[model samples]
Target chain A: MTDRISNKKNITLSIIAIIVMLAAIYVLDIVIKPTSSWSNLMTCLEKGTIYALVAVSMNLLNGFTGLFSLGQAGFMLIGAYAYAIFAIAPEDRATVYQYYEGGGLIHFSLPHMLQDMMGGADAFGGTIGYYLGIILLMIFAGLITAVIAFLIGIPVLRLKSDYLAIATLGFAEIIRSFFQWEGLGPVTNGSNVLRKFASYDSSIFPVLVAGICVAFIVLLINSSYGRAFKSIRDDEIAAEAMGVNLFKHKELSFVISSFFAGVGGALLAMFQNNINAAPFTSNMTYEILLIVVIGGIGSITGSIIGAYLFVCCSEWWLRGLDAGEFLGIEADFMSPGFRKVVFAVVIMCIVLFYSRGIMGTNEFSWSGLFNFFKTLPKRIAAVPGKIKAKFSNKKHKKHTENVKEAQ
Target chain B: MEFIAKWLPYILAGISVGGQFALIAIGYTMVYGILRLINFAHGDMFMIAGLVMVYMATVLPLWVSVILVLIITVVLGCTIERVAYRPLRSAPRMSIMISAIGVSYFLQNMALYITGGLTRTYPTIDWLQKNITIMGASTKMVTIITPVLTIVLVIALVFLIKRTKIGMAMRAVSRDFDTSALMGIDINRVIAVTFIIGSFLAAVGSILYFSNYTGIMPTSGSMPGLKAFVAAVFGGIGSIPGAVVGAFVIGICENIIKGLGLTTFSDAFTFVLLIVILMVKPTGLFGEKNIDKV
Candidate 1:
């Protein structure tokens, strides 16, 4: 009776936490007024939210299920194209006719309810309705990707982790190459589909969409099924012995992860108003993996935090490259590619020193919040001491200890 | 007869490329054989070696550039083992594999940053670029040289593994790491030598590859690396001669697909082949069928 009561309390607390997070996001969406310059920043945040969703979903497989997959981008591609085909306005499609001349012919007739929901098929018809349509399209995209993931996972997931990584990486490449083919352009719009979609002027829609998807996934993870997933991750053999269906759980997690990745892709496409095979390359997979690794594998909140830091750091680092101009070193010392170089260096340092990543499997909790406030005084008082500790003594000892432990 | 006549040139080209792949595949197989890690960064090492050769040729004479590239690649290979891999020698195989990927990404991105992501062209060495005709098919002198060199190196590698003291150490380490260490082998030195030999082979393959292709880019390693990895897996990852055979098969199959008017699908063909092979024989063509120990 006591255990049951505690379990109930735990569920209630988690629900309250999720509601609070959603409320905060909603407030932020309203507070951050759109300006011409700040619009890009807002969009970046929106895009970051989408990436956070994808990263979290990927963590389900990579972090929780212990399955190393590179097919996230492929799933995203599927979702982006599906959402585009389903949601683009008919008149807007005509304007983009030159690029997508055959698009109209390929789209099947929409269901009456969907047409009504989309405000009678006209461009910019009921604002709320169109918004709803976009959400539906994103979900549809996720479902389609989930189906594909299910089909692919059955045979491929049987392979061991390393081979699985190689196989999935190859699968992503194949998807990209397929999208690049001119013959498949009728449905895919090939490389030109990005230009055909309507851009969302407000960043709120994407943020809300991505946030909801992430929350749903988090809820799922905290459920009994989620414990099964964690069990598989901790030890597959043991999990199997304990009556957990290994193949079933793995497939479920894979499909769910791929589904969210697809939704994230659709949201990404909506934000950019255009996407190409170029951005969704193998590098994208690596970048997502970096986010997972840098944030803390198996932690959803960590994935979110890591995505924000990574995107912001990359932007700031890129901007700082030109800051050499202010210092009078006008020799073009830092090229644009210097950002990736710096990013790689940072990743190496993090992998070497802080292999558990920033959050180290810890989530945002009340106690953590209290600790942050408590430590603020000491952190501010001895900034130099803290910096020195991070670099010279503690970090080196930690890295060496990790290396020894690994060996 | 007509099909054979029309396909002969494509077949020859395929074989030439296959020979080049075979050279790189040996590196992957040997490393996997010794340590059950895939060495994801092998392709990037090849790219770096090509860059080194290009840089050296700019300053030094052709033969000297070639020799220096080989030496530098071997040293770099040994350094990678010592720094990135040696520490993770006792970690889970998956962790080492992940580190290998991290190292791979680090090398490629570092190259990207340094080289500005531009395609670097090799200086036209008069002899290397010379063309030759065989059975009415036009081919580069490098293509012919690649096969000959590949065969010689494979023979040499096989003999070294069979006869050398270090080779025995490598075999022992592969069979059981702690046991070999107990036998008083200088495990670190042997591992370094293994990496050096692997890197040396990769360097040779890179030179021939870039010479024939005429260009090198920061991202050039990814596709070749992936294909070579697949070849390693196809041949029973830890088997040396098996990797060679797998490389030739992949090269020839890819070429045949291109020759049959599916140039766009050639890259996909390799993965499709891997998936099919994996489904049919998970341990690979020549892999030892081991039961799950756990």
Candidate 2:
């Protein structure tokens, strides 16, 4: 009975914390205008939310399932393209697809179409319809990518380890080239940027979407299927021996992880307000993979923390390093690409020395936090005594050495 | 005659580029044979070789710059092995691969910072730049010289690997890493020698490659690097002759696709071929089959 009550209390506390975080984001979004120096935090929050989703999805496959697939960028490309292609305002099609002669295919806009059915954009009904349409559109994007992943998985999933990584990487490159092919110019815009798509006016859209997706992922990870996935990661043959359908579980994880990655891509496209297939290279996949590694591969919360830290550090904190005036210390060697160089070196150090990363396959818990805080004062109070003991021990060792020499 | 004349340039370019790729692929195959690593930074190393040659040629004589480039590249490759890869010898394979990716990222960023994102013009070697005619298809002398140079190097490499004590050590290490160590082979020394040979060949490949191109960018190495890796895999990774053959095939096919006006698919074609090969024969044409143990 006490355990049940404690569990209820924990749930309530978590809900409260989430509400508080959301409220804080809303307040910050209203207070800090885009032009302010502090706006970097907002940009970080937006990009970080998107990256968090992608990183966690990747963690699902690479960490939980032990499938080292490197096709996240390709899935993201499909998602971004699907979202952008379908969400473009019908009137803005000519302007966005200037090379395609009014986008020979995909003429309808999901939001605009839904808005029209609900008495146009000025009414409350239309406003609700627009958001609803966008929600459906994002899901549609994820579905499209999921379907493609299903097809790709059939042939590619049989390969082991590094071969799978390389094969998926190859598929990503193939998808990139296909998207850039001129014959598919009308639909994909032939390597040109797709823009003027429907996007969120407020940052809450991403935070909410990412929060829900992460919650679902967390729930999945706690389920029996997640345990099966973990078993496979630990030992595939052993997993098979224990009656876990290895291929089925692997495929399920791949599809679901890819589904979330696709949504993340759509969100990314929304955040950027434009999309291009060019930047969706193997490098992007590597960046996300690095994020997962930094976050402690098997921990979802770690991925979230790592994603935010990575985005904020690279996009905001490291900006000063690039501009040559970080912390009021200016140096001639600090140039445009110096920040990335420094960032890469730091990542190398992390990979080499701190391989367990920030969380080390552990999840965050409220009880753990409370216990840490409770012990903080006691730990701090013991610091000076420990230091004195160390110093006296060194002195005693020196005196003993002198006495021995005299003897 | 018209058909032959029309197709000659593409085939010639293919053979030349194939030779260049062959050099790079040999590096990849040899390293993978011993270490079971993809060595993602090998491509970046090739790019650095090009950049080093460009900068050195401006201040030093051409021959001196070439030699210096080779030495610098060897040093860089060995240093990377020592610093980035050696410490993680006991770690999982994935961790080492991630470290390699990290190294690649570092190298690319370093190049970007040094070049200030500018495309450097490749210094033209007079001998290489001279036009030569082969069967009514005129091309740079480098086109002809690349294959000859590549064959000579491969012969020497094969001879060394088949005859020398270090080569035997390498073969033993690749065959069984722990067992070779138990047999008194200096594992670190063998690995370092592999990097030396790989980097030296890559430097040579860079010289021949950049001689054909008018400019070199920070990203110039990635495409060729990937294609060469694909070649290595296609020829059955860890097999030298297989890598060479695979490089030639992919090079010819890619150029042929370009010749056919499907220019965009030229890069994609290599991957398509890779997937097909991987699906049809996971062990590749010359690769020994690996059995998973419980």
Per-model C-alpha RMSD: 4.9, 3.3
For residue A84, what is the lDDT in candidate 2? 89
Best by DockQ: 2
Residue A267 in candidate 2 has what lDDT? Answer: 97
> Poorest 10 consecutive residues of model 1 chain A by lDDT?
A104-113
lDDT of 2 at A10: 87
Model 1 CAPRI quality? medium
lDDT of each: 0.79, 0.92
Over 4 Å off in model 2, which ranges?
A: A1-5, A378-407
Q: B70-155, model 1: which lDDT tens digit per residue?
A: 99999889888877888778776756776787788888888887777789897676786788877777777876777788778888
Over A80-126, each residue of candidate 1 has an lDDT whose tens digit, in order, gives 87777765555555554346565444543232235466666464555
Q: Which regions of candidate 1 deviate over 4 angstroms?
A: A1-40, A92-125, A191-193, A322-332, A375-407
**Displacement of the residue A12 alpha carbon in candidate 2, Å:** 1.1
Candidate no. 1 TM-score: 0.89
Residue A334's lDDT within candidate 1 is 73
Q: What is the TM-score of each candidate against the true structure?
A: 0.89, 0.96
